[model samples]
Target chain A: MVPPDERSRALVSVLGTAETKVTFEDPRSIPEMVLAVVEAALEDAALGWHDIDAVVTASVDLFDGLTASSIAVTEVVGAVMKPETRIAADGLAAAVHAVHQIMAGAYRRILVVAHGKASMAPYWDLTAWAMDPIFLQPLGVNFLTFAGLQAAMLARHDPHAVSRWATTAALRRSAATGGIAGPISVDRVMASPVVASPLRAGMCAPVGDGACAVILGDPNIGDRNLGEEDVRIAGIGHDVGPHHLMIGELTDWAGLRRASQRAYTLAGVTKPTFAIVEPSCLFPHEEELFVEAVGIGTTAPHSPGGGLFAGTAPVISGLSRLLRVVRALKGRTGERGLAHGTWGPAGQGQVVVVAETP
Target chain B: MILESTIRLPFSYAAGTVGSRFLIALREDQKILGARCTSCSTVTAPPRPFCSSCSRTVTELVEVGPDGTLEAWTNQPGNGVFGLILLDGADTPIVHRILGTINPGTVNAEAINMTPGARVTAMFAKDRTGRITDIEGFIVEQDDP
Candidate 1:
């Protein structure tokens, strides 16, 4: 028999969630953008700024082009005097930290926020700075190069991989409702400029500027809007794979698999039977890798409304995915949802969170 | 209206003991080096202090290759063509330029087979620096031998 998770003693519920429409460039500054999301999230949770006990945020200095970039959201997230923790990776990772604090009975309510702006500079250019200066960086190695290399590795065995990726990108784009790069044809996607070998511009997600905020709290704690049914986080697991793309499993997402397995065990999910799945796949080829890693079979409703293909911010992607799952669970359909996040070159870091209506 | 500003920040990184050894060998003797793991037996080129897989400190630095197999490649239209080369002795691949001919920029990409499993030999630069660029690129092996 599988052992039950002992550390998750307290059930952490997501009280509220909010996000901005992802755009190529947000007109407002970082603080103003964060403030809007914070206000909406507070309103959704029916809590005042004073009610927030602590704040956790996800951001990166290289992406934000500012040291301690999380400072921008301090006043908005109600962290002026309270303790605040900043995670330099994906937004969902911050939520995971918030979940940890809530489970530890550290605070009654914690606010998690993540923000990113691709428009500030050439986003891909910034990623090159993260690679090994001694070996990879001088060779002009960047994240896009990593994607192309992975796709090329996968295409070696499968003759039809390229065509399939084009189809997947087209499907995702067409399904997107308000996506910046709306509904492109499969033919057009194939003909689009090749950013990397075997991967085209159309096969990539539309990156933009945005912010996401979510409030988590202990249901046992008394609040004015206490409800019997709430969307609670059931499980969370994160794993960082090998940093080097060459040495690691280039064709598979080993880290994501392990993370999902750990999360599944905590959530008591015996199979890949999620009502909805939100994965942080930046490329169309990655959608295939995500499916294989999570072991989600043909039936799971994955990435509704085109998911990241619709358009998402860099650090905010994983967190925004969590928000989507939270919103869907509010219907109280007894549905189980999965939210995933990834960081570093390729799938170097992977985080998974499981949520359900209770 | 959009205002753009170009900012330049200079930085320096120490190559460390193992990294210095790897680069020194490439420059001094046109030889590729890989650090073998004490625990997992995995060898990673452009060697490091510890193994990427097992996290065990690697002490045995072995010669990897002047010849390797092309694992995968990409041709960025404006940028150059690059490939993942699986060195002869090493288990893992390293990313580097895949030079099709004497002049890479002018060569026709389709003329050369960019597919995996093609054999290639490393070409070293005449004037070498203790850097990754010491090995200029790998050229596809000719069959006329």
Candidate 2:
């Protein structure tokens, strides 16, 4: 028995990939936005419809206002007649699931994709559904509320937390937007009105529509046609914590701690100091939470310049982090990088991935 | 232009399964119940017959708290009202409407503030319906009235 904790597996590399082409328009339609991502992934990977073996997509059916929304997305990703699986969490969750397939000797290669657009429906509405229906629904709670509660908790203790979050948001947004969305200044973030106590509009992640795609395959049959530069995935782990935010200790993300410990063991990471970390931080405060939970402290440069506060593509946000790690590692900027994704209120579900340069 | 039509999805609760029976019980007596996993001894609200963790059928009935703490709260921007709530007894949280106006300043005040850890109590409608909405929603308590 591998023993659940010490289960080490061989590494797999992420093949050529592409990010969604930004179309600066409000209320972006799902079909229109998703097709662009599919087309871009196909073009970037230099692969046609015939190259893909199976497709794995991540999406929440309720968010799309359609049940089994993955069915509609398959055609765009070229998954017609291919085995498909839908993950109800972040894009990174689907990517991790794909890695499992490859590790289990099930499929040789797979296409992992995820998409989310806050334009089609209210993002808050979608987040609210994740709450307890009988008790929390009537109260009308959403993710932002949790952010507010966390902010309130921080504000009661730390004097500089809110200001620091504002600074982080401004810095990230500036780096992510280059003739993309209009530049937002630190002054703008400071001046933005508070949506929830202690959390301002600028501190929160901007809702945007986008899609992400990643191709994975065994290294033995490494095809030169699919980009020579490869970033290998060394370790991956995920955990779900207590759903009730109030009952569990909010300050500590124990779920993240356990997940990172598992991932580091799998990746043989004795020391994570030199690692470049890419984390899915919807809000600046969340960035702090993720960093603290992973035990990286302030030692590692996170998101390089910015994160989801830069602009989030919903379910695709986590995979966006993975892509960021891939780009950074391929550039020789970092030897090993940590990418983390969190779902539900106060980080209910957590996933961690460690990517290293081969 | 692509043409689309509005699809109405109307479904009913058969209450045949044990999970449905519990829902029926909640509607009949405003009793909140949960299914306890035989293997792990974890009680799940929105009860599940099969333990998600152990993959074993949960046959034990564990009546959790009729009241739960308000873990989180929010108001729909427009149209209808909704919130995410975790009940006292069950492991899973349920979403329902708040009985009265949302108060932002004080916990569960008439205003629109959804502070975490706000104390809330469930309110059932006079008419009985074997659906999740039968509870109408939960209300944040100001004090013993």
Candidate 3:
């Protein structure tokens, strides 16, 4: 029986990291995307495909333009003869599900991966399907439109909301530079056209192509754990709010608060002190909302560089946050950290992970 | 010069366990079937053979009443309105378009316009065939008031 409160005795580790080989013209296919993530996980875990027990992947079928997108990429994950589950939400949601399997005493040494290539389809048009068909979709709403709603709501009270969001966008775009596209300046962001009222095109995360993977195991294995360094997944929690406009409070995210409370309780964290905090901030306004929802003190380091605005790959955004937090924890300056991820329309769903150096 | 590269994605789909069968059954019977999970005792509309909650095999199938109450409803000015109707015999709600009974303009006017326990009934097509569209949509049961 899988207890809802069963703490994860199984510690998950991050291994070799390789992203999709992206180009303006020829981006990596889904199969190739899966292969890239598989190689990274196998190398990082210091094991071969023979060592893997089961696989849990994160993807949305609509985004992939294929029904049961996992089926197409399953072979490349090397799960030909193994158990696999696909999470329809964000990458972090998939990671959370994988942690449950480990703690349930179901299997040991599981692989969790997520990949997204936003270049394939029209992201805005596609995201419309995620909204409540009657209320939101008819408004022609997508993530950008939702961000506009959130931004406009905030701007109504604080006139500086637009400027602050623009500044945040400039910062992240500059940080994301050396990757696929180059950097942007505050002036450039200010000059960009408004995609939604109050939210200029510059205030959003750049759609990109990438894949990520993590290897989790029953901590009771070997002399130590799976990865060269032991990184324990202390707590995991996710929640979905009522799918309606009237019920959801536009100014506050009660769902994120509930999710974090549950996660902190499992991790046994009373005081959240960390050198790093990574949030899946798709828009600058969302970054503010996230920091407020998580109850992070002003003193706490928040998205040290920039968040989704830097580079975000839909389903992989949360895993990317995890990767950022892991890198921070690996560095000697880091101790405990938090990674936050969200999906659905207007942050209707959320997941948080609290991990500490072991 | 503009370079247009054609992309084609071809793959066989499951038609989903419930959605595919619902189409066939709707064509033949004009009655909707409910998938009842033997384990949790949950019923899904336009039935499937498996329980989503328990992931257990559905043991029984039953025809739901053509009559149900509007649990919630909404409309789009130019598009359409969708509602969740809680059928008389089923536990879960079925989502469908609310046809002539509710005005599309008023539906989209505000979210609070939808009230729970509001009585509504299915409006079937005159020709009578088994298909989701066979039930043209739901109509407000004005005879009760």
The estimated TM-scores of all candidates read 0.95, 0.76, 0.69
- Write down the TM-score of model 1's second chain: 0.89
- Model 1 chain A: weakest 10-residue lDDT segment is A1-10
Q: Is the docking of candidate 3 incorrect, acceptable, medium or high quality?
A: incorrect
Ranking by TM-score: 1, 2, 3
Q: Which segments of candidate 2 are over 4 A away from where they belong?
A: A1-10, A23-39, A42-50, A65-67, A106-108, A127-164, A179-198, A225-229, A241-246, A249-251, A344-346, B1-7, B13-145
DockQ of each: 0.69, 0.16, 0.04
Among these predicted structures, which one has the highest lDDT?
1
Give the C-alpha miss distance for residue B29 in model 3, angstroms.
Answer: 31
Q: After superposition, how far is residue A281 of candidate 2 from its true place, in Å?
A: 1.8
Greater TM-score among 1 and 3 belongs to: 1
Native contact fraction per model: 0.67, 0.10, 0.00
Q: Which parts of model 1 have CA positions greater than 4 angstroms off?
A: A1-10, B1-3, B101-110
Q: What is the per-residue lDDT of model 1 for residues A192-224, given as tens digits with 9 covering 90 to 100?
A: 999889889999999999999999998777766
- Rank list by DockQ: 1, 2, 3
> Which is better, 2 or 3, measured by lDDT?
2
TM match of model 2 to true structure? 0.76
Q: Is candidate 1 or candidate 2 better by lDDT?
A: 1
- Model 3, chain B: what is the TM-score? 0.70
